[model samples]
Target: MTVMMMKVFHVLLLLNSVWTLTGGERGVSCHFGKICVFPCKFSPGDNILIHWHLTPGNVQVHSFYDNQDQLGQQDQQFKGRTSLFLDQISEGNASLKLTGVKVQDKGTYQCYTSTMEQEAKTSNINVNVKAPVQKINMRQTENLIICSSDGIYPEPHLSWSTSPPSNRTFQNQTTVQKTEELLYNINSSLTLSDREDELEYNCTINTLSDQRRASWRRRPSVEIISGEATISCSSPDTPLSGFSLVWRFNQRQMIVTKNEDDEQRVSEEWKQHVKEVSESGRLTLQHLSADHEGTYTCEVSKDGDSSITQVSLRSDPGKGNSHVVIGIVITLVVIAAVIGLVVWRRRRGSKCTKSQKVKKRENNKLEKSEDNQDEEEETKMNSS
Candidate 1:
């Protein structure tokens, strides 16, 4: 009986050792580009050694011995990125903190602890790193609107919404592509309606039961070059909502109009210059001269609701104004030169006239002296 009891005690010790070696079964979830901690604890003592290793790769992530961290053989991948709770080391806490955790960190980690009095003990933890999904793009291409998102994990769900509320669901097609890194790239497309007014389209991507979601809204915008500017009007979304859009020049006369009934009308004079009027209510003029430069009004009306936007096209007048300034400067320069010449000539003429008068007076004085001398000579001759 004593021998049998001893054998049973040995069997229990073996089972306990096996259980310790196996470590824990539950895993931890972490996000990429975040911090992860592998928890460990022991009784306070000296001559302690705690080492952490990444399994499968057998990489030594971190180690501590003689009351100090020893990284002479640390893994190159985890260099300068792993640390321990140094303050709590004396209290037997050997938790490992990893900074800037990456997708490669998704694996099993082993924390082995040894002391002078106790044998080595090992604990295991599994980490699952999740890559976040951001950067959703919405673009309009011709008659189709496409929405896409890339680099997402654990799959993502997509949904769409429109403003001004409509019961009709857009016929959308979604495609998901998986990358080599186990991430997903998703795209959704929908055909637009030939509508005049703008409609707001919203695309949303939801992850893991809506715990996280990202949405993007499409806003209509118009951009035209400076010279021969094209006055094209657009709503938030088209080929989805049919409404009437009208183009008015200087807010006075209607230059063009695209009705919801697929009818487009252009003014008689505008026909000569209208280059292309699209079904989407975009009016492009061939040559945008000064007559076309003014406040252009885009009026949209649908179901008793109307929106008007005025776009002022002011001619640059940059080169033209520069030329005018040069002409004015030249005229002023000529006028100044003419006035200076006239003043200089008048001053010269006055000085010449004054000098001539003085010369005439001197000549008259000489003639009087000659006549007086002749009379004196005659009197002397008479005396002789």
Candidate 2:
């Protein structure tokens, strides 16, 4: 045999020795619409061949052969979504980063790496894509009612409903947006009736595997300009101890917290503005300014049940209260005037009835006299 043949035989023997050497299968969890990485590492070299395949069909996802990436046979579903750490490949890192992970991508992946001598090392990764975190929000401006949600996956479906059926047709507007992190953000709006009474609104977000719903009913709005503002979240009287209250601003910054033991904590930025923390989870902010205008969320937990309440705050404090008072006063004055007018009409109707009765008696007396004259004329004719 030639000398090259002898070296080839020795390398083949070495490959057979380490062929069964492999790490245990690892479990990987990935969020839907997010990036998922399957880790594989080895000694850095250019003579290594890495092959990745998905089980159940043994579909080739990616392959690095002959010192180059060979992807002509990659599955269409994983096209453009699969990537290898090319920069670190020379350093023996064969990790794959999969972007925009979907439910269909959940399965077992095999990483097979072989050196120039055909010595092989294998590793298995079981990937699971998780559902996205969801949150729903609602807002109202004059006659417009809007509902929105953020950080959802798989293109969520949104719908709106009302408690009492309204005959009026609502204008619906919906939009879906993808963020830099590959999460879906949805916004939907419905124009509401101009009714003064409180209305019940329901917003539902649906995914293929999960469905979450949120109900929002109209609450009495309070506005204060340059004055103290109070937001409250209270529950029914329960003997359960260990209650906790948390307040958030605009769904981002936490403003205050009160524990069941009556301990209080406030945010540093809002320390001066936070005036009081009631035992019932009421937050009072003093010396409010335009900067305080936003949505305030109050979360209360007792026992094991939790409740959330959101309040919208604005800066037109004086106008809102004054308008309410003026509207009440105007309504009261109009009602009083209507009552006075009704009383006047009743008195006039009574006087008119008395006058009609007197005229009717006079007409009856004249008719009787005429009838008496007619009877006397008839008697004289018979006697003649």
Candidate 3:
């Protein structure tokens, strides 16, 4: 058993906590408070030493030698508590065994080799503990569905989808909340036209199970729109994949753009002047602004959902509006800056002013010389 006793804890920088380098000692894995065993991945004739030291509080842990008979072990904190599984050492498996584990062991651990040809190699291992997700909930309001879920492990992902996979019409809201490590929740709403018939809702949470990820779905049928800006959230009957998404502006219907860029720009423009879409196939106009001050149309169909919104700037001639006043203000600022610059340059020093004047005079002289040359060329041409 090789235990290096130091005044402070010291962990090796290795690539793997459990691997073997071509010329170094092997790797190892051991838990806290229990008997941790490791193998030295090296031949019997190898001239090397195996050592272990933990540094949560600066303490020399342990060490062992291969060819030479050397002994410089640590204090009693790690007497019978540490050792190596020597049987596999000659095979180049340098694994360390720890008899006891402390909370201070909750940091990066490594296994390394410093022999010839193998160069330097190590391994780093990060250990963590997590829980599980056990519950999910979803509620519907108007044309939007607020999805809430909890009791998840390994951080669950939240998404809105179709229950039957028809890819029907719907919008996603942006309000979300994370309540716990294993729990999360978000709320999204869709807009529906008074003409729409049905809407289905889906909320999915993804988490880990047996080191594998599993997806859990929570779906609920929601209400249909009976008025403006309202949407329905319910599953459709014929598996909605074929249904076209519809959009409307104010009360006018519009067409959905097939090109992706056009759709994205349209959506961006919509957010600027309108509400986003909800899973219920209804487009929402978040807040009314002067930018939102125009005739809008919502278009819905079987292919996709889109909207065309107009905007009008309300003008008040009596009291100059912000846009006009801002321009005047900017013009005044520029004028002031120019005046300040002129005054500063002119008053800074007579030497600078004189230099500028000389430069200008030289430029004028050059122009006169060029002009005279051109005139003389013309006269010479006439004489010829």
Candidate 4:
């Protein structure tokens, strides 16, 4: 019934008397290899207590000595892996060090402390044991291949597979430190085979989160022409579970699938017109004619974001026959005229030099003569 008890009881009553603040709080968080401090500052005689516990209703991970020995059952997953920086506790350091972290270590952790007057206040700590983002750096180590994934936590697994999903040889070494937390360093390697599909090697790092699996992909690549004719193909960096290739000829459409209905009638349009280099995404047409011109698009996709390329094929390189030829010739002539004007301007003016003036006058006369000749030719052609 004292002032403090009245206020404490009132606060606890309002807090549902759980003596704990459950939701809506800036909880505890730490990177795998870094030191994370869980604040647990309580007045010496506040009748409040603090400790750490796990779910499935377990005992404490560790707690500061009220003045003597530490108490509470440390989590098994966290056993021999965590240590309360006991030195800082007296000065208010509730930080814990988690060592040799694994991918399974990421989760929501709690920091609970009770106040006899009020209620138990709990803070949440989110520990993220991130797997290294597989970095694909291709290297030829004297016929032995070298690919690495740095800048990651909890050393990751590196793998190489063919598109048809065949296992290959690889070796990896992981180094870790408690002082550095779970800041894991891994050097994985395997004697890569010298295959014709060398560039088709894919490296992936696997990790799990919330019962979901995830990965990154680096697809094999090739550059192809847009039109006339080109091959839309890739060897692939990783093995594919399934495979399909299609060529589309809508001129505007970029994907065209092969006809698969009848077992015998398999030859499509592009196949008849274009020949591809075996086992590669390279194509060659027997002859590139004007009519064979249209946008030839290549579609390549695996997992997500299939790529479609627009290859512009030309029905006619510029325009068509005689009229177009004449028009082009006229255009070229106009462009030359403009270029001559610019050159003359830069030369300080055609009028400034006597020789230039003479050349200009001669050119004007020549132009007049050329116009007359052109008119005569046009009249003759029209008559013919």
Candidate 5:
């Protein structure tokens, strides 16, 4: 009897080793701060038991017994964040649902379950948590181009590349900061070459789960000489089959919008300025004056990804020259008026001097005549 009992014990040990080595292993992924469900199953029976533990430390994540949750020894880190499907437990579903998942929650989990008349079963689940990279913003100020993104996890990476690839190495700076929520924010800037030739810049943010890219090409301000201009949404060679395009002026006013159906809508306020939209999404603007001198942004969106191109507009140099010419003409008119007033004053003064001299001469002649008359009267009186 002792020999038989030892043989049965050895058989049980071998069976246990096999189960430990070949337990169901799978991977599950969930986003950070979201719910994650760890799949598990067992045979249906009376008085079911389920327990979930973190591997390596065997930390208790959740437990179920007596047809209810038994969390007396649950880990503090997982308290109030772990749950089981109570309604689905009797059907042999031993899945554990975790809420508000954190970065530290990424690990291997062990789900153990048992029943009154069935052997205990174990499953290993590898959990992966991710915070995907979102909207990347790219802008340029003179020769400096900046790109940034916020609220990403797993420490995103930033890289810069240029189109029409240049041989000259670019100088760039990058920084990463942690937010209060423990997510990452990345920023990078690139100093472009002094050459004014057209070049396209691309900024990319990469993570284990997702990647986002933004492309921009700085264009010199357009000087409209003919009171009209045509601004292309993208390169003439780019395909616009499944894309939607939007044209905005100064970032607020919507100038025109085109959808995938090839329908174009122009804002009422921009009707006079927007002349036509071509099949390739080129915008022809008419009657462009000083009021139209600002930034015009073209956004192309397809499948949730967007590419933006910006063009700055300015009134014709001749328009500005007209202002300068008007100022010069006004100054010349003022100077001419001043010189004409001085000449008229000098002529009037000379005329007044000549008139005074003529009056003096006439007075001298009258005085001489009066004196001769007085002498004649005296002589006549003496003769009488």
Candidate 6:
């Protein structure tokens, strides 16, 4: 009898080990404030029961039995945020759906299932919650450009790169701070190279769930010589897939917009000025006058992140001609002043020459009169 009991105990331990090996822990990643699914399954059977609990403390997260959810004992923190796949429970799907996930929900959870025909079984899942990096704010101050984003989870990394590739290394300073809600915020600054001209700067933020990038290029003011002009919305190297482009005039008036599908929409007020929009989001304006001279901004948006480019327009058909005309008038004035100076100097020289000739004639007359007087005195003395 003792040998038979030992054999039965060994069989039981072997079965338990097999169960533990098959129902090991798995991982499920979820974005913060988004829906998360914990996948589990078992052999389909009648009288199914499912219960999900937070491990280490056995806090009830969700429960189901008798073909309906039983949440009376559910933790208050998971109230209204947890649900089970009721329709698929009969098929052995015991997955739990969690909505509005928070940092507090990140931990190990146990899914307990049982049926009248089969013994109870448990599966463990580790939930990892993260907040994706989104909406990178970028700005330039002098030679320094700053890139920043907030409300991220699990921390984030920031990097800087230049277009047209530079061999010189740039100075970068980055900081990550944890918020009171256990989320993270990242800020990075890059020192721009003074020797680089028209070099595009790109900033990228990376997280476990998502990565976002933004690019900035300083453009010189556009000069429109004729009555028409074309303003490019994006750089040639910029990617346009899955992006929405919008063009605004002076930051107030919406001129045109194009979606990812290439559908274009033009504003009613700007229909007269908007000639056409190219496939690459270049805006063509016709009948452009001085009124059209202002800042034209192009905004490219995807998901929740955006990049912006601005073009300043100056329209004046006669501007170049006016400059030329002013130059010509200045040249003519200088020429006229030079001619007047030359004529004045010549007239003064002629006057001085005439005065010298008149003085010479007066000296000749005085000499002739003195000679005649001396001859008359010599003749009188000889006669006496």
TM-score of each: 0.46, 0.45, 0.26, 0.32, 0.68, 0.68
Superior candidate under TM-score, 2 versus 6: 6
lDDT of each: 0.70, 0.74, 0.43, 0.48, 0.82, 0.81
- Model 1 weakest lDDT span, ten residues long: 209-218
lDDT of 5: 0.82
How do these models rank on lDDT, best leading? Answer: 5, 6, 2, 1, 4, 3
What lDDT tens digits, residue by residue, belong to model 2 across residues 32-73?
A: 778999999876653667778787687789987556788998
lDDT for position 4 in model 6:
54
Q: Ranking under TM-score, best-scoring first?
A: 5, 6, 1, 2, 4, 3
Q: Which ten residues in a row have the lowest lDDT in candidate 5?
A: 6-15
Candidate 1 lDDT over residue span 1-384, tens digit each: 354553354345433544457444447787767898888877666566777888776688998875789999998889989999999988889889999877778888887775555556677888788765555555555577677888777688888776666577698999999887667889999777555135556667767733233222233333333445565455432441488877787667888887888677889978877777665556676655556666676766665344455455655565424556688899999999999999999999999999999999999999999999999999999999
Please identify which of the two predictions, 2 or 6, would achieve the higher lDDT against the true structure. 6
Question: Cα miss at 263, model 3 (Å)?
Answer: 51
What is candidate 4's lDDT per residue for 270-370, written digit by digit as tens? Answer: 45556543333334554455555544544444442233333344433343234557888999999999999899797875456878778899999999999
lDDT of 6 at 329: 89
Candidate 5: clashing pairs of residues: none
Which whole-number lDDT from 0 to 100 does residue 315 have in model 1? 57
**Candidate 2 structure lDDT:** 0.74
- Once fitted onto the true fold, the runs of candidate 2 whose alpha carbons sit more than 4 angstroms away are 1-29, 33-50, 54-131, 163-170, 178-183, 222-230, 234-265, 285-384
lDDT against true structure, model 1: 0.70
lDDT of 1 at 288: 52
User: Which runs of model 6 end up more than 4 angstroms from their true locations?
Assistant: 1-22, 139-144, 167-181, 195-197, 234-243, 249-254, 286-294, 299-308, 315-384
